[model samples]
Each structure stands twice: as C-alpha cells, then as structure tokens.
Target: MDAGLKLRGIVAGYGQGDILRGLDLDVPAGQITCLIGPNGSGKSTVLRVISGLLAPRAGQVRLAGRNVTGWSPWAMLDGGVAHVPQERSLFPAMSVWDNVLMGAYINADRDAVARRATDIAQRFPLVARRRRDLAGSLSGGEQKTVEIARSMMLDPPVLCFDEPSIGLEPRARRTIFGILAELRRDGRTVLLVEQNARSGLAVADNGAVLDAGIVRLAAPASQLLDSPDVGRLYLGAS
Candidate 1:
C-alpha cells in the first residue's frame, strides 16, 4: 500500500523535554491505521504533529509524498489533512446545521459550501434530523457524528482522529467504529489513536504499538489482535 502520510525521525515535545523521540510511522492510503499504546506514549502527540498543532523539533512530515513539515493547521487542512480532536469542538449553543457549516470556514465560495453541506447532511442523517437543534442537546454519539460530518466539508483524503470513542457508551462506541469503517470504504486514509485497542484494531487494516515515543511493534491488525503477548501487554487481557 502507498503511504498517505509519513513521519520520519520525528522529535518533538513541550517546553524542555521531548515526547516523540525519533519516531517513524507510515499511514497507508485508503485504509485505517490504528495506533494503540499506554497513556503518555506520545500517541496524541503524533496526531498533533501530523495535523500541525505542534511542529516537530526535527524530522519530516509528508502528505501524499509531499513534504509538509511545520505547516500551519490551516495549511494542513487545505492540503487535505483534517484533524478531529478528542475534545468536543462544537459550539454548544449553536444549532447543528450552523456547527456543520463552520467546517467550511476556509472555503470562499458560498455555493460550494452550501452544496457540500447538503451532501454531508445526506451522508449523516443526524445532521439533517437535528439541523435546528442545539449541538449541546444531542447525545455524545450524535455529537461525534456531527463532528465527523463537518470534517467532510473539504472532502479531505487524510483524516487524523484522536480517541474518537473515548467518552461514549458501548453502543455509541460501536457506532463510531462503524463510521470509521465507512470512512475506510470511502477511500480515506485514516490515522486513528484509540485507547480502545480491541475495537480500534477490529476496524483497522494495520496496527502499530507505540512505546517510549516510537513504534515498538507494527503488523497487520489481525496478527496484532491474535498475539497473546500483545493481548496481555496492550489489549488488557487476563
């Protein structure tokens, strides 16, 4: 598989110390690549670098074979990389339709934004059903669904998700995972940082285990899921 996003020898951190110490990762095109690791393993930091929330101290970030290191968040978005953070990004007081429209903020053409909004609403019925409802009025899963729909405003080729299912219930978690599978089917390259390793890998084509800011293990999702050592160390198996 061709690499949709690539990180080579990444070294980044906050203040004085480094979190990602020479990390290397490749997110393949048109597939879901799940990153699973213990807390403080630089999982979220990786997403930050990819989405330009944090610039790496060293190394390179490549998107579709183009060097994009140190680009701003807006530039990254324009370059077809959309990031959905773990925290809820909606304006609680705003209507769902309004929140979705906010995704097209960078687009100058009103007609194009309107057409994309319509297409996204159709793709995510929750957006249409709650078009007039305040974003805070929706359930956790519903809110997440809207967030994803909004991210599609640009029809990006690469999406980076940071623990998308973190606060949801079991059914909602399933729904989010289903949506992730759908994104893969739509030919989007996804880089997922998931705390729920089992569910994440269940929907992913590849899995990488992060430890001490670098990839400790990289393999097919099925192989990682079936590995007894992996189960004990990362998957929380007894």
Candidate 2:
C-alpha cells in the first residue's frame, strides 16, 4: 500500500484523559479506510489527531513518511490533509457555493479556487443547484454533502470524515456511501469514522475496529465484513 498517512504508537486524549493508547493505523493512497467501533472507542479522537485539532500526547503522525507528529493545525491543512467533522460545518446563513469556496481560503489564488469549485460543483450537484440557497435551508443530508464538497477545496490527497452518516436517513446514508465510493474512484485516500459499520465496511478497502484507542482488529474490509466474529460483535448480526 502506498502510504498516505501513518500513525504509530499514538496516544491522545482530552485534558489528561487518555482515549487513544498506542493506536497504530495507516491510510494508503487512493483507498477508503474505515474505522468502526462502539461509542467511547476514541474513533473521533483519531480523526482529531490526524487533523491537528488535538495533539497526540505521544507517537508519530506521518504524512507520506514526513513525520508530521506535531505540526500546527493550519500547517497540516497545507500539507494535504483535509478533515470533515461529523457536525455540519457550513455557515447556516451563507450560500452553498460560498461555503464551498471558503475551503480554499488558505490558498491565495482565486483562479485556482474557482477552478476547483467548478470541478466540485460538477461532482456535487447540490452545490450547483443550490448555489444561492442558504446552507441552513438544505436538509441534513444535503448539508452534509455540501460540507464534504467544501472540504475538497485544496484537492488534498487525503480526506478524513468523522461519522459522515450520523444524521442521514437510510436513503441518504446510501447516497453518502456512494459519494465516498466516488471519492475512492477518483484516487483519494479517505479515512472514515462511521457509526454505520455495514455501509462503511462495504465501501472500505480496509477496516479497523477501534476500541479504547486501540485497533482491536484490522483487515481487508470485505474479509472483516465476512468474518462471523466481526459481524456479530460490530454489526450486531446473528
């Protein structure tokens, strides 16, 4: 696997409360890697650490093996890591097109931003159709789609999504996963932390079960999905 992001012996937490202990994981180039587990499993913390929202107490965070263990939040963005948090991140009063353009605020080039926005609109039709509607006017699923489209401003090589299907209905959940698959088809590394284990694993190239900040099991997503043990424990399947 071509390395897009790597975390080794990573320990992170909130205010002395350690959630992730010695967690090691990898996101290979052009693949979707899903992290699934029950609540309090430190799934979101891993995304936070990767995005530089929270610093890992120990261990290494590497981008293509560059050892970005302790880079600033802003630096990490410029380094090709884009994070889409579970919560809707758009400005409720703003237009969807504007919100998507904001993702490229770090880039000083308007032409480049415009070019990417065009690409994203073509990819995410909501952005094109709802170009003038207030972001808050969209449904939860539509808002989530816009959030993802916004996160692609830089065309980062790696994209990390936290609980992307959190508030979507069944049909919307299916659409969200479809979008994720499209991302993979475009050759982007996607590290998704999802509560919907079945949908997530179905689209993942690799899947890891995270518990108490540790990866309990890691394998090809399809294999893990087929494993009776995983299906019973994580999927609640008989």
Q: Residue 20's C-alpha lDDT in candidate 2? A: 98
| Candidate 2: segments with Cα more than 4 A from true spot | 1-3
List model 1 lDDT by residue over 1-238, tens digit each.
Answer: 3439989999999999999999999899999999999999999999999999999999999998989999999999998999999999999999999999999899999999999999998999999999999999999999999999999999998989999999999999999999999999999999999999999999999999999999999999999999999899989987
Q: Please give the lDDT score at residue 181 for candidate 2.
A: 95
Model 1: per-residue Cα lDDT at residue 21: 97
Residue 16 in candidate 1 has what lDDT?
A: 90
Candidate 2 per-residue lDDT over residues 146-202, each given as its tens digit = 998998989888899999999789888888899999989988899999998988999
Clash pairs for candidate 1: none
Q: Candidate 2 — which pairs collide?
A: none
TM-score per candidate, chains pooled: 0.98, 0.97
